[model samples]
Target: MVENRRRSEEPLHCLVTGASGYIGGRLVPELLAAGHRVRCMARSPGKLRDHPWAGDVDTVRGDVQDAESVAAALRGIDVAYYLVHSGSGAGFEAADRRAAEIFAAQADACGVQRIVYLGGLTPRGIPESSISPHLRSRAEVGHVFLDGPVPATVLRAAVVIGSGSASFEMLRYLTERLPVMVTPSWVHTRTQPIGVRDVLRYLVGSATMTDEVDRAFDIGGPEVLTYREMMCRYAAVAGLPRRLIVPVPVLTPRLSSHWVGLVTPVPAALARPLTESLRYEVVCSEHDIATYVPDLPGRPLPFDEALSLALRRVREAQVATRWSSASAPGAPSDPLPTDPDWAGGSLYQDERLSPVDASGEALWRVVEGIGGENGWYSFPLAWAVRGWLDRFVGGVGLRRGRRDTERLRVGDSLDFWRVEEIEPGRLLRLRAEMRLPGLAWLEMWVETDPQGGTRYRQRALFHPRGLLGHVYWWLVLPFHALVFGGMTRNITLAAVKGAPARVNEARAVRIRGDRRTRRTSQR
Candidate 1:
């Protein structure tokens, strides 16, 4: 550990944009633990409210797209961490450029002493035009910050191997799911992957440097290996059987992306850029960062150790943040759902209410622990098939399981949905993020019945977009009877101990005055 010295200077005030994102979320607590005052900026501040360290720092509700908000967030900040990125592969470079320019200008105008940006690494000696769009955007953004008035330190890194990170997850799913693979030629291209711990250490160390930093530093793990080797090594470390990778020269990036999308939770849009970048070597070409932050607690961890640490987090469900935490670029804003009639669409729903002899607390406990390793209460094989289908079609799938087993709060990702709202022991509403023809929500509520027992209610709502939406609903209605019906029945069985619970009825619900329009079906 670095010695914590009593500094004569005042404690630095830091601002972290994308504080809800993977790296940013993890970095906030690190800065706080180091005794520096931190301000977290997020577009949706509600998402950050229930974080474990929420109350420990100040939060500014704002987006980098808005100049005024960026300016406000930058005010009174000594050091700023720009950790935001556009993961959408199409036309994201332009958006990233605009945001970076605005942030740089705001930081400069606000007199921020130092600005640090995390960017992707492009190998030395390659022309700028030859770089992948993703890496190109990152390099350009770094330049924007460096060219601005403030002294900027840009740290370029390759794939960060961490649990919940997109790259790590892609590697994980590919290795674990496929026994033999026809891989692309890029798999043999060398890359210097770094662990998240080292990346965070370098970031925190940057804050304490006495000398001014105005240039870019390339950072990576000590070992350099090809993508194919990394995958085999990962499988070896995880104790999986050896995976056979048959390399092919004809598979294009689009084809590789589709293959990856089908096998992994990653979408084709996000996977394409990453696939393209793998064609070139990404090993670090310089060691300038060591001069600034010398003798880091552990300069660099071994590849096996880094891979194991990430896997351990996955197995333990202790992932701090995910790459998908931030909203995608150009995605329409999802406002808090209001009344059903006001929603402006042909809305359809599947509702189930069951009366149990158990207390509200017991029923709520079962609902809260529905997804992940708990196995969806019932029809686990069906659930797994659905998740695989979603992944096949480039949807999020169920790979992003529950963050916690028993406790949940708003903004938590449960399987393929996000917790839109939660009331302890009373209600849980999850907004769907999976690929769908319409918007969807799964809500569970616990209430006390007049007879002094608990009533468990489950609702799945969908607001269709067009004719295809209606068709999709009808097509899946038959399966819902099996999947959703079994789900309600099983949840009741799990909740009610010793005392038998009775299924009340299934109803078709539309949001609005509850009693107005309801069609009940008795089992």
Candidate 2:
């Protein structure tokens, strides 16, 4: 077709197939502030190198049912974004219909110029009966991503409020810790939810609508709520008060996604594919996305100002992630969670005083090359803005950092601490992955007590797992007593205040809420 109408009149080269998704991480910064030329597609492009749209993207790791990484992320791609999904694999609808039948037969032999997809909204004729199986495999992966590419728009959204959405962080943790709820009957099922800035303004207004090929709109947010009136409009935008919801029709969606995986941290295979795709209904009917966003003004902000801007973006914890595929990136979690809010117990000690010209094997080769992707020596952009504000209020920040940067294991993941014990010249321990209402630790030790020389000890321990973990460690004990007493007086004034402070393999990090990152050895 004239090379698909000369590649849809050039100027798009996009290819965002679930580029580390959550609506392709907010549609790659609205398709790069609308200049287009994305190409993200991931199986982990170096864990999306610090995404904020990570340098306006063009990455490409693989797997869209890997046909050579979706034919090299659809070579010369002009447009192809069918967002991958695999809510806990092993035949996730035959892996989302064999990855949309192998990226729609390699985006139809790579002449691709269009295919945008982003399904969810389900109400049309209102006969969604018993619809589960993850919303009928998300409506059969939107009919195999509009069967074969090049001319497919499909928006169809629903609960995408944002801030690391797991249906808006399980309604901001059952409205900030069960203020008083007992929800069921899919909480009253209705839903129209939309937000993430109106699903990136209807996927960048369906990438400049060109006679909406093979279309399928149905967006949302004009309000039609119900998940217990959107969790009392997110407890009146988290100021709380009004949660008295006691429906309880035999709590099930596998026991409310395991009581929403114990008061929220949404994991139960991503909260059972977000509670089995909300039984049904997701408003949005004609008015054709306001006749194509007629200046996308108002009328999409009720339900308590979109749950108070999605709980002020999860209490202003500035997240930039919502990773799923059940936390892939070498997935393997389940050896610790005993749900007393994820069991805790820790201790650490680190003491130092050597720089008569510094060298305990060069400070144990900079604390055994610290974490993965080389980082964590000292204040890395305040530890990546406090691990993107603890992943924007849902926790587990700086994403478990150590996957390998100079071998030193015991259940790795070393950013939000997880080494849990190591000794190269004297102990090192860590365990908190941020989420403490109880146990936590970051121990470090290196001795020489008889006064032969060194003596470093650094500790930040906590074991509060009950009275709301001792009222959240005495309400963050004076900011964890001034960030662990000013980070052990700035690592002993940078070991005599100078030379030996350079190893940011890439800006070291591990800090958030009384900040952190520990592991010290010298001799």
Candidate 3:
């Protein structure tokens, strides 16, 4: 009888599309915590392999636009999550509609019981014809799922505030960078914003609701505030000083997008959609979700509380997912080039060498533990500025750090870089993941000198795309001097000082960076 009861207590199996996306990445862990089995579908399954919960669920390699892959993913899935959106490039609306049609058809064919989709909250008191393309596409996708044969629940939310979220980052940078600003009239447009944590809760909870929930439900945080008010509240929570605002209607969404593109990490494509949507107010029109799923144990977090949570995650360096995790549309998914001349392209390099009176193993320890809590072995302030700039333009930034301090494996993330090669005590290669105009890499290695000492080589290599890449490198060359030169000196010094107490030979010696000794490495 016990065996029979155990067999009857099987968990529900769910398939999550867009597993590489921001909310989808976080949603997998939440679903697992809720005792449901999850299957993540990604165009490149390798992208999900590094996630903390990677081992907890199954992954299927597929795209929603491909009917076969969709059917395969939907096989035996009780609930399917449609979290994908093509709101970036040209004709994204048509692309979104086609993807939704294919997904709904496949889910129905696979006999999935219910489909749960997350979309944007529609603007209130506005005609459908005048609705922003971003919101309109989202609503249409939700409609496709609801109209399918399977029962479906559509959860529409406003801006989601969380660490690494594109929407939240825009607000964060704008408020932090500018104490006084000329703003568009849309800054005063009232809208409801929701915490990512609360949104996740609603998403996970909706899976358990019965088929009686077949329509759309609007979800949001407890407060309905203007974008201006939200930014001010964020500043208050973050302990930032009061900001001055001047409203101006002359700055249209296009102009605002360009300005935001320059200031924030979000590019013009994403910024345009966001700015367009902000022209109208987006508040929860119905309380159906509250009645259907109910609040988790306490009142939902207000704007300030949510903003605090996001900041805490950033401070702790515990971000589970970033908005940039999704692979670029045509980027190569394979590991970055490790061979110096693997690709035929124009190359420029900066190389530095430091002689250390330590063993190769000793030097390797310092190199392996270069990032994370140890910090970069150079101009930390400059590194922080670059990281901030990267984050503003939708790059990974330096917040990711290293997965392991004492050790590294190929494919591990080191700050805004991905490890491409690790040769034990000999070498380490990192491919830049931060937004750049060209391909770049930082390589380091330790070798035994013929004179019974350790020699460390550090090189920064770039393959320019066009004039932009060349200008970018030259523009930052001076900063690189302070960063790279100091980095080489400090790394060798750390190796010498960090040598075991018994190694008196290493402990007695010192090293310093000499830019005059610099030479370009083979590329």
lDDT of each: 0.76, 0.62, 0.77
Per-model TM values vs. the true structure? 0.66, 0.36, 0.68
- How would you encode candidate 2's per-residue C-alpha lDDT over 81-126 as one tens digit per residue? 7877786656787788788777877887887757777877776674
Error of 1 at 373 (Å): 25
Find the 10 residues in a row with the least total lDDT in model 3. 331-340
lDDT of 3 at 36: 92
Query: Which residue pairs come into collision in candidate 3?
Result: 264-392, 265-392, 265-393, 265-394
The order of the candidates by TM-score, greatest first, is 3, 1, 2
Judging by lDDT, tell me the better candidate of 1 and 3. Answer: 3
Window of ten residues with lowest summed lDDT in model 1: 331-340
**In order, what is each prediction's RMSD in angstroms?**
13.7, 18.8, 12.6
Which digits, one per residue and each the tens of the lDDT, describe model 3 over residues 1-523?
1111211135678999887777887788788888899999989998877676789899999987889988888898888998999987888888998999998898888877779999999987787668989989999999888888888889999998875466776787677656787888899999998888888888888887776668999999989999999888876886667888888999898899998877655667878999999998899987778786677665477888787777663233221122112221111111111211211123568899889977788888888877887788888898899899999999999989877646799899999988877889988888888998766878888888778788999888775543466688899888778899999988899888883333333323421122223432322
- Candidate 2 local distance difference test against the native: 0.62
| Model 1 TM-score on a 0 to 1 scale | 0.66
